[model samples]
Structure formats: C-alpha cells, structure tokens
Target chain A: MNDNNSMAYAQSDTAQNESAQSSPVQNNSIYAQSSPVQDSPSYTNMPLLQLNDLCKRYPGMGSYMSVFHMNLIIPRGRIIGLLGPNGCGKTTLIKMINGLLTPTSGSVLINGMAPCPATKKVISYLPERTYLDNGMKVSQMVSYFADFYEDFSTEKAYGMLGALGISSDARLKTLSKGTKEKVQLILVMSRQADLFILDEPIAGVDPAARDYILRTIITNYNPGSTILLSTHLISDIENILDDVIFMKNGSLMLYTSVDSIRSQMGKSVDTYFREVYAC
Target chain B: MLGKLLKYEWRGLRFPFLVMMIVLASTTVLTCSVIYTINPNYNEAIPWYSSMALMFSIFLYYFGLIGCSIGLSLIIVIRFYNTCYTDQGYLTHTLPVTTRQILHAKLIAAFVADVLMVLAIAISLFLIIQVTLHHILSFIPEFTYADLMWEISRGIGEFEEIFGIRIGLYFAYLAIYSLIGTIANIVTLFGCVSLGQLYAKHRIIGAILAYFIVQFILQVLAYFASLPMYARMLGTSYNSDFSFFGLMSPTMNLMLFFSVALAVFMYFANMHMLTKRLNLE
Candidate 1:
C-alpha cells in the first residue's frame, strides 16, 4: 500500500538487476535455447514461468492428454499472448501456472520456484469466469483484495472503478456481465505482482468495453511485470503483444515474437495463427 | 493470511448466520409469548378459538426452531461447497495463501458458526424453559428467581451424588464432546466433497455416495468401538457395584478418541485433495 512496498512488489531485485544488465529484448534470445529440464545449467537466468515436460491426463480417459509434454519458458516484462483454439489446453496451461490444477507430470516454476504460496504471492491471476461472490458489494470486494494481497492498490482499483462509472456500493449481482468483467480486470490489474495471467480477458465484451478492458490492462499493469493474455481474439490484442505462444493439441507449436512472426512469416500474427491452426 | 482469509470467510457467511440467529431469537420470543398466554386454569376447558390460536402459535414456534436449527448446518455445508470448490473457488484458490491456510480458515469459520448456533439454541431453549416455568409457577405463591436457581443447583447436586461425577465436569465433558463431534462431522463432509470432485462426472452424486460410504464405515467402527462398553454394561447391573466412570468412561473416551482421530485425518485429507489433487471444473 505504501510506495516502498509497492516498489518492492512492482519489481524484484533480480528482475531489476537483469533489466539493468541487459535489455529484455536482448534476453528474448533465450527462447531459442532448447527446452531445459529442472535444475538445468542453462537456466542461469530464471524466466518468470518455465514448464518442463508438463502433461495432464484425466483418469479413465484412456491416454488422452489435455496438456502433453509441454516445455516452455515465459520471460518477464513482456506481454505474451497464449493463442489457441477451444480445448487446445490454453486454459489448462494457465490453470497449471496459477496452481489451479496440478500437472500429471513435470513442473511449472515461477521465479525458480514451483507454484506454491511463495510463487502465488507474485502471480496475479484473472480466471475466465466471474469468480467473485455475488453477495459482495464492489467496495467490499476491494477491501477483500486489499486484505489478502499486500500488493493490491485500493486507490488505483477505486480510480479504475470510478473511470468505468461503476459504483463501489453496488453489489456484484446487480452489475451487468460486462461490468462484472471490468471489475474483475480492475481487481487483477490493481495488483503489483511480478506476473499477470489474464484468461480470455475480452472474450464476450462489446467492442467499446473490450477496448476499455485492454486499455485498463495496459495502463494499470506494473512496467517490470509480465502479462500473459490468453484469447482467441488475436487481432484485437495483436498490437499490444510483444511475444506470442501458439498452443495446439496440448503442446507448444510456436513460441516467437510478433515481429518475427510478421517479418519472417510475412503475415500478421492473427493471419499466421489461422493458417497454423486451420483445420 | 489465515486471519484475512477468516475475515472474508466470516463476511461471506455472516448473512445466513445472522438470519439463523434472528430466527432462533424470534422463535424463543414467540414460544415465551405462547407460554405466557396459555391460561393456567385449564381445569375449565379453554375456548375453541383461544385453543386453536394457541395450537397454531405453538406449532409455528416449534417449526421455526427446528427449521432454523436444521437449516443453519445445511446452509453452512452448502456455502462451504459453493465457496471453496465451485466457480467461486477460482477467486478463493487464487488468493496468495496456502491451501492449508484456506482450509483452516474455512474449518475455523464453520466450527465457530456451529458453536454459535449451538449456543444460540441452548440459550433460546433455556429462555423458553425459564419463561414457561416462571409462568407455571405463578400459580404458587412463593416462587422467585432465587428459588429457581436453588432448585436447579439442588437438582444438579442430586445428579452428581447419583452419578458419582461432578456436574460441572460432566457438562464440560459434554461440551467438549459436542465440539469434537461437530468438527468431526464438518471435516468428514469436506473430505467427502473433496474426494467427490476427483470424479470426472456426476461429482455431486459422487459426493453423496462418498457420504454414505463414510457414514457406513463410521457406523461399523462405532459398533466395534462400543463392544467393550456393551460387554461391561451387560456383565454388570446397577445393584451390583455400578461405577459410572467404569460403565460410561470407556465408551465416552473411545468415542472422543475416535472423533478426534477422524477429525485430524479428514482435515489432512481435505487439505491434500485441495492442494495436490484439485481439479476445478
């Protein structure tokens, strides 16, 4: 809540030192490295999130895996888009990163630590659904977040709520669906976490609300933090994305930058995504 | 973090809890009013209208009391399922707290709510009984609150002499047993829900089945556990060296021990499922 605490949360010392030592754009080269297992010597510079041989298979499903043998690293300070079709394991991957679901095999590490309370403290997550208690008023929700998340800025949250013309006294059940989504986004973006994972942030909102939601996400997130936005609506958020990770059939198909996808592929990311994932 | 979790948990549950309290209080007041209104002179038959009104009031009072008592626990259980393992779990499980911490907060909140409900019911019952006794004793000339207290104390003394255990200690044991029993039931329900969620389909049905299976197992254990007590009771009669401690202590201690063990096991089992085995649909 204070400037010192906010600064501490906004950027970890290692991240600050890494940023000062080399530009994040330069560190993007690390993605070219082969998938490293846990405690690999190649993992000198810790990515914000790293998944190694990650697989999730439901029981009695006869070997049909949801997310299979996925190995990837998500760096900090970049807005990465996790693009995939429905049931492509995008949400499952996100849930694994957020510790919502455990992987049937392998590991997901946040800041060199597995998804635990320590990692959870630095990872702010917005689920795809309206997960708030309907009985709670907007102000009560704000208080709840503040009480639980030390990095949560009540002032910024209220300011965003005000800009959206959402009354703090209004109960969640009384709010429209779009309004509730906006509130969820506001609550998520209000945190000064090192990693922000937003799942389908703008899926069902109107164009204007979608624009507003994207703007809120862009403006409110801490600079040194990473944002992983998952949505099928790639073009709408393509401009804001620095990197893109294409997932298909529970495996990582591509992990590259938008610029590379554009310059090398000679097409927009969305167009490229359509071509890659075309059935 | 546990405290914060508890604060929100309490906030979420406070509405139903307050409503239950209000219902109990209102029921107690209605009961007292009915008792006060009913004529002591029943030697002469009461009017039909008055009798009908009295019957309705009494029925309504008891209905409200029973309904709130039953509803309070049901609401608590449903709220637990809804908040911890339902869609709302996305918000809850994402908070920067350990699964154990979250479970602790829920368990503590539910335990406190159960305790409060029990206390409210106890107080309401005592008030109703006290008011009814007061009204009934109005027929006698020299009845007072002090006399009432004296009578209670004398009854308790007589009970202690007969049972060969101190009244306060007996009540304390009962309270401890009740608390442990409530916690055991709650944790077992949570364990069932957690286990049920492991199924890929028909989770609620799975939960119900889990409940029945767990209840059956517990009943079997209880039967085995009470064997010694049953044997002791059967072998001895009240006329021949009946020891209250010997006759009752083994069963009570075994039950207390079992309940405590089950509560711990269920707590850990619930935490394990929430942390390692959680799959939120």
Candidate 2:
C-alpha cells in the first residue's frame, strides 16, 4: 500500500514538473490527464521550448489583452497539436515562435536560446498562408530554401515532391491549392531540423490529401525532430499527435497527452474535442 | 555570404536588367545611325566637331533623363527601397540576414547597378563617336592628336594655368547633386512605406500622401533657407571675375549636406517605426 502511495505521489510530482517546464507559472490541476508522468521512467528530459506570459491584442477587442498570458512547454521528438477555432491566437502564437510576430511581453526559448538566426536555422516553419512568390517554379522555390536555410535538404525535398507526385518544374501559381499545400508540407518536412512549426497544415486540403500529408510528415521529418502543428481539424490529426493543446478564445484550455486525454475523457479525442469546444 | 545575397538580388533583377540593356543598346545604335545618315559624307572630310558635340550633348541629356526614369537602376532601387515594408517584405525580414546586412546589400547592389548603367551609357557614347565621326587621318591638319593631347597636358605643364578647373568643378558639382537626389528619393520611398505600413488599412494611400506631405514641408523650408545662401553665393560670384564654380561650390555643398542629412534622418525614422510598430496583418 505504501509503495502504491509513493508511486502515485511520484507520478503527480512528475506531471507537475512537466507542466511547470512548459510555461512558467503554469499549474496542472492534477485531476486533468497526464497524471501518470511522475511514475513514468522518462521524466527528466528538458523541454525543447517554453512559452512564458505570451499575449497579443487586436484593435477594438474591448479588453486590454487579446491573447492573455499563454504558457506552453514542448518536449523534443513529440508531435504537439495546437487546436483552436479561427481568431483563437493559434496562428499568432505560432508566428511568435517562428519570429514572424513579436510577443507583446513574453519570452520563448528554443534549445536554451532565444529566436535568433541560430534558433531559426533549427526551426523550419510552414506558414498558414502561401508565402512563396506565386510566379516561382517548384525548383526555384527549392533553390531559394536551399539558399536561406543551411539545414535544408534539396535531395530530400525533391524526393518528397516526387512522392507527392508534384513536379519540380510546375509553377506555384499553376498548381492547385491542395497541391500547393502539399508542396509546402513536403518542403517543410524535408528539413532535418530540431523543430518544425506547421500552421494549419491540412486546413484547406481534402481528407485524402490531409491523410497523405500526415503520413508524409510522420515519414519525412526526422525521428528526433519536434513538430508543433496548429489546426482546427483535430479529428483527423488526433491519431498522429503525441500531445494535444486546446485553446479557446486566446487562452489555453487544456494541455495533456493523447493517451491520458483518451483515458480521462473516456471517449475518442473527437468526442472530447466536441465536448470541450461545444458552443 | 555577400555573394549569395548579391546572387539572389541579381536573380530578382535579371529580367528587368536584361530589358533595360536591350533598350539602351538599341536606342544608342538607332540614334547614332540616324545622326550619321543625316550628316552623310561629312565623315569624308574634317567633321564639324562643335556641332556634333552639341548634338551628342543634347542626346545625352534626353538619354540621362530616360535612363534615370525607367532604367534597371531606378527600378531596382525603387523596389529595394519598397521591400522594407511591402507584403513581400515579410519574407525578406525573416531571412537569416541582419537588418543592417539587408540594407547594406540593397544599397551596394543599387550602387553597382548604377555604376553599370553609367558604364553602358559611356560605352554607347564612345561607340557612337567612333562610328559617326571622321577618321583621325582626315582631321590631321585641322586637329592633330598631338595638339589635342597637348591641350589636355597644358595644366600639368604649368600649375598656375589650371586650364580645366571650371570643367572639373562643374563635374564635381553635378555628381554631388545627383548623389544627393538619388539618396533623397530612396529615403523618401522608404519613409513612405514604413509610415504607411504602420497603419492597419489604406496603407498605400496613406504612404503616398505622407510622402507628398514630407516633400512639401521640406521644400518650404529649403526655399526659405535658399534665399540667403543664393544671395551670398551669387554676390561672391559676381565680385570674383564671374567664378561661377567658386560661388556654386558652397551652395552645392550645402544642398548636398542637407539632402544627405534628410535622407539619413528619414532612414532611421523608417527603421525605428518598422522595428517597433510594424503592423503586418
């Protein structure tokens, strides 16, 4: 009985530590999922990224803080999901991580360093919108990525494009929207970097394309690489995610492991998502 | 790394640059051919050198204006200046290069392009002169190379002579004026974009209006300041044996200094606004 009690206490302590590591001042409710982390053997690894007191406010939002005090901890080699509806600050948060948007007042650290050129080198990002010049051919786009990102893999990118049945000679404008999205995913996943931040990777694509994208992401990204994927299509990507973060409005609702959420919610993640995000 | 930056810059500019070169080459050939045809048989004798010089000078004036307005140099410079705050700039700013490095790359590429344009124009003029003018043999009695070369060598023989001081000074004055003008134009463009981008909507309209407003204010201030400076410089020139060079020197220096300072001020203002208040929705 004492051993069991000690194990339970250990599990709670580990869970607390994990939550704390994600974002400073973040407290896990203990009743939420991911309660067994303290009892797990692998509890000491440091988080790859930590968000502290992040916020973003739009004009005429009525309140001072639009996105108020967001904190998150992301571990290495994990597919972390940021699930939210439109205008939930998921895109803003992702942009902040990629250094596209500056935080109002917060710090985000990647591999113990702030988002500098070195950090950027290890973080491959796929923006929600198409950022590439539409006139460029796929080959030119690849060459451009090759120029800017030292860690980018041209051969791997080409291989991924080939697997996706995308032609390197195809102009970005000429490709269908779904094909363009797939091309973006292929380019992003081809990088052998430490972190991958994919915003709405499968939002506009069809189910088949989305499935192919998820599979491609699983196969192409290095095993040790961390991916932070933000999307509203939670039901489709739930199977591949190791962890899930639910965001409502501009604040975090819940962050827990997939297995733990499954056990606690006593249903598939889709059902839990519907229940949690129900209007 | 600089080479890579330049390579990308050139890649972005290659189509425009190629077209500009083709246009310049064609225009140069056409103008020279027309002039030669108009004065047919003149090349068989000693050519009317002064008349040809005047015609060439007139061609150069239009050429310079056209080149400045629509050439690759202007296109690239304007685009470079605009890139700091355009929608396309979201990619540019996120590149691994430093903000200063980006600025330096744009400026250096622009300067290089400008130099190339100047070289092209110079070569075109040389070719026109070579093709249309009478042979040196035909002009031997009237204008010997030895005499011409001696005329150029006169200033070196006697220090007091200073035979071409006015010409040298005029070139210097014109160069300074052109440099200031180019810098001012680029800075104004940057300032407009930066200020315009700070707004949430109607950014392009705001930018255009802000640019005109700034220019109008500067012109008013310059006009007031120039009254005194002009009076002093002209007064000095009138008293000094019509030494327009000496009088204009101070005025040119002041304008150049003012223009440079304005450009630098606008550049910093733009950079500061961008670094802090950039509202990239």
Best by TM-score: 1
Q: How much is B155 displaced in model 1, in angstroms?
A: 2.9
lDDT of 1 by residue, B1-281 (tens): 99898988888778998988888788778778877767776586767766776788778778877887678767776877888788899988888888888888988998898888888888888888888788878866677767988998899879866676787888888888888898888888888887787775888888888888888878887887789877788778644455666678777788778877877887888888888887778
Global lDDT of each candidate:
0.80, 0.67
Docking quality category of candidate 2 according to DockQ thresholds: acceptable
lDDT of 2 at B48: 70
* Residue-by-residue lDDT tens digits, candidate 1, A1-279: 122222322232332123222322223343443322222333347878878768887678676677766777776677889998898789999999999998899899999998888888898899998999999999999999898889999999999999889999999999999999999999999999999999999999999999999998889767678899999999999999988876666666556778777775688988987866666
Interface RMSD of each: 0.9, 2.2
Candidate 1 versus the native: TM-score? 0.89
Q: Write the per-residue lDDT of candidate 2 for residues A197-234, one digit (tens) a residue.
A: 88889888888998898998888767677788998888
Tell me the number of clashing residue pairs for each predicted model. 0, 4
Q: Where does candidate 1 clash, by residue pair?
A: none
